[model samples]
Target chain A: MTGTITEAAGAADASAPRVREMSMQQAVNAALRTVLREDPRTLVFGEDVGALGGVFRVTDGLQEEFGAERVFDTPLAESAIIGMAVGLAMNGWRPIPELQFDGFAYPAVDQIVNQLARMNYRSRGAVPMPVTLRLPSFGGIQAPEHHGESLEALFAHVPGLKVCAPCDPQDAYRLLLQSVRCDDPVVYMEPKARYWDRRPVELAHDPGDMPVGRSRVLRRGRHATLVAWGAMVHRCLQAAEYAAEDGVELEVVDLRWLKPIDAEGLAASAARTRRAVVVHEAPLTAGLGAEVSALVTERAFGALAAPVERVAGFDVPYPAGPLEPQYLPTIDRILSAVQRTLEYKRP
Target chain B: MTDTTERTFALPDLGEGLVEATVLEWLAAPGDRIGRNAPLVELETTKSAVEIPSPYAGTVVRLHAEEGEVVQVGSALVTFAVEGPAGEADDGAAGQAGIVGRVPQDGEAPRRRVRLRPPEE
Candidate 1:
């Protein structure tokens, strides 16, 4: 009779989840709200985060509800913002600090890359650096100089920092909540371009359900696989939509966590289709695309019908104003790369 | 003889890249006269609940959406029977992008929004 017991836990966990239509900005706001309500030791602070509700309004209404003590604003100093987080995290507090923009994070690189990234290792696992650094990253908002930049390659290169970028509203909420709850230092990159994009988000998924360092194949295809994250993930999905009209079904993979890159999942997707194209907004030379390309080539070399293609930004600095469109890879560019992979010859 | 004009005041962008909101409640009904800066409708955006204001002193000729109805930005909220010509109501003044950087546009948005970090099964 004891052996007759079946594992119905998976079915119970799959009970109807709450699916609400929300944008990435709203999802982030919800995540912060949930954290502040659940954890008394968690604190949110940054420039214009309290009263102004962040420039993107991602932290909107947290101050009004949580009070200034828990959700407060800091001075317009990036280093101080991150330094404060390091101090608070050491003192039994979980601090979520904001750098305003991707370009602004440079001022805090010393604190982030040197101190924060090394604290846990320096302490030999004694100090758990529970700090979540929120950064509005990547281009496409036509931001002026020092507003839009892609720093994933820099952060992902860091040894101890956990890097992740959500591609949709649901992941935005779940991943942020998970990152805040993590014991290590997490770099939470909020895509500035997809903040307003709306989609039906399954809201009932708890933290750790989709843990960090995992990739999801959004669309399954046998012809070729498209790998991307952040804003480029949506662009790749759009390219797949257009390719479907031409009887070409492209598999799209969303690598949510950049740092512990999901090599197994990336390789599986590449091995299945025998053709893989990695797309990103970062520059091509030494960009994250190169790392992804190398991972794909290393893990799935024998299964490949062609070499992995990377459609990425140019090596020059991220252009400003009207020149961004030319610098960032377009849907046409991704499709062209896919076409090349499909038409590959032994020559 | 009273000569009047009508202007359709659509929902303006609520800032922070929000494209639509659900009508929580409507303060003024049709045929009601209201002044500028008057509280018009309470909307529940994804962020928080906000009350919109009437543009100018005008007679409300029509209510475009009922309570609990989701209204898209740039869609008509209320048509006003006012005492001025078209383009004078100044309803679009609130649609300016509040944050730094380029604003988000609908369908094929060149200056679209982006997110980072990081999920799903």
Candidate 2:
């Protein structure tokens, strides 16, 4: 299948590609398997990725065919894995290391920000970290502490990292391949909870069609513009579905890449809807949502329907217990923000 | 010992398309009893730490690749000795050469395995 949304919809070629219903994790596995088979240089590494096939079985059976050299296990150390990846990138290899869970990525923040991210800039573009760091992030899985934290904001704050989250299986497959092929380092956030949720995806499109830092308008609306990424993209869609019953039309933009933001798309969306609401898994303060909101307000001040509202995680460390529901963004929360934004009158 | 029990395991492309990877450490050795999906070795690729699972349920008879040596894709990494069903012997080399010939070309753009391409690009 081409995975090209445009081609899939219009092509009169009745011969459709084979389709299978797999979970998000499975889709990711398929993507990895395909890439690894296609590119002999693409390697997968993470804790328990071999015999255990990763704690989530995202890498099951890889070792058998790929052998110990290509598909093996790493020590239970996050920092070491990332640091090693940096070294590998320096030596002309593409590394895709899994952070395991969202919370575990913190241990490697130093290598990520100070070393991997800055290597290219400090070297005056002589060297670049083409490594792709995959993080299974966000809550609702009911996992323990540090497992479902949304830390894209932290990486987004850095200058070098290209942060993105794929909402579905097709995006999971395509975005991952794209990230691996990209020249700059990319932080690919996988929403653990929505691994199995199914939606139709395009088969093929021109490579490099979806550029980094471009926000995709997932759905069109006239009342408000909802800017979101990763898991929240799904939530925003759900919120749009529900709001439709109440005659509320919303424009939803999936901010696929974070660092080099799609300011133009966002500003244009805000111009059409005249209302903006930023949503994310991170807290409002110092979050990417805040940055996006500020950017829209500063750029689209003349076409404002109301102040840009943000729906995001609370300002606290992600809780271990049931508080996870409250820690991350929700559909209701997004809807409420949309309603609030729509209600705000122009001064 | 029957020759039918021996199986040749080809190196799989770990999630990354690394040309060659170093065996950072070996978890299993020759003559070790191994099961399908068992942890055979810990490999350090250019990306991260990873473990290689046993592709065959058998004993490790021959170690083809050494630690710290860069091994290429489709290369033979290990030979497994298996117990055939009901006193029967198996050929380890049979049905494997075809696999080597079918290795997908690297760096092809993403093509959907199922379904047509979407309408709006």
Candidate 3:
């Protein structure tokens, strides 16, 4: 009954807004439909986005609804996709281009990091790149090489681009809408694993509910805080719930925005809990986990009770197929990290 | 796993002590009712194109390797939901029955023929 399409008690009433149980895919599809319907200048284009829908069928019926000119496809070229978005953005068209997959964005790094990301500053505020590049990112689906790489650190390190990944269907809908509306070039990373994740989404279309660069606390606890983003957020929440059964209170913080991370939000929770553990799918070295741990340590050092722990992927290449379960941080790994932070002592 | 009998057939020796073969095409797909000795997949090893025969009569459950993948000798090629006894997997002693021709995948051409298993007794 969770993922099945269910109607609320009030049948066909016009009094209240509809609350539908939708998968992240349907929620995002609805968001795109709303954006395309509302804005005339907005154009959605990318590889296989036309008749093929998408590799994941995320853009299932856009071209039929919006016509060929507005929702179209490009040749299988990632660089050209970003280049055309910047050109259209300069010409007063709001462009929302899908990079197809996370690893595919590597082919367009120059267009992303150097040109599209920095064009506004180089042109001295004359050009605002209102381009939202949707990249289906992260692992857990055991995709082949170059299909499931976690490249958030690469994009978040860049100064000009704003990076954000949403965990649930609600965030997936709202953050996508917010990313499309923001003037700054945003790399909207949708966790590929959570695409089919079902949740009751309030279809109010409030993109302004939570702005980009803000983090939200999904669960509250006074012990250690499990900080994570994207697909790993759900895993951390599971660990928190499991920890609660053992009389251990673990706070779960969804660090939604990778870039411009909410330092105050992290410090506020970490200060109260006195311990923190960062989890991510990317490898540990120079990863966003390190950044989160550093930020928490820097801001909450005085209030901290123990050292911060980071449970992340091994410092090796992201493995494919059968090796992935061992590579990814499991719920037990997160619980162990929380236990270590809880049991730490001064030597 | 319990309800259906399945066999994960591995790539057999095409001929002459070959180690690997590139899958050129799949002649059978999942849900297709396959008969024993039917053309299962086309392969190229050492510059020869060859087709491997199915070992059991069953519904194709899954294809372990995709086309163009260089599957190693004795690696999983296909899994079939067959009708058979609850018997233990045969050991590798009778793995190489006879090399009729050579089969290759990934790095070269494919040719020749080698039965995956003796006809079900």
Model 2 docking category: incorrect
Q: What's the CA RMSD of model 2 in angstroms?
A: 14.9
Interface DockQ of each model? 0.12, 0.02, 0.03
Off by over 4 Å in 3: A1-17, B1-121
Using lDDT as the measure, the top candidate is: 1
**Number of colliding residue pairs in each model:** 18, 49, 19
User: On residues A212-248, what C-alpha lDDT tens digit does candidate 1 reach at each position?
Assistant: 7989999998889999999889888888877776778
Candidate number of the best DockQ: 1
How far in Å is the alpha carbon of A254 misplaced in model 2? 1.2
* Lowest lDDT block of 10, candidate 3 chain A: A1-10
Please identify which of the two predictions, 1 or 3, would achieve the higher DockQ against the true structure.
Answer: 1
Q: After superposition, how far is residue A198 of candidate 2 from its true place, in Å?
A: 2.5
Candidate 2 local lDDT, A62-140, one digit each (tens)? 7775777777779989999899889988988788888788888988999899899999999999998889898888765
**Cα lDDT of model 3 by residue, A86-112, tens digit:** 999999999999998888898999899
Candidate 3 C-alpha lDDT tens digits along B57-111: 6799999998999998788888888664536333322233223422212222112
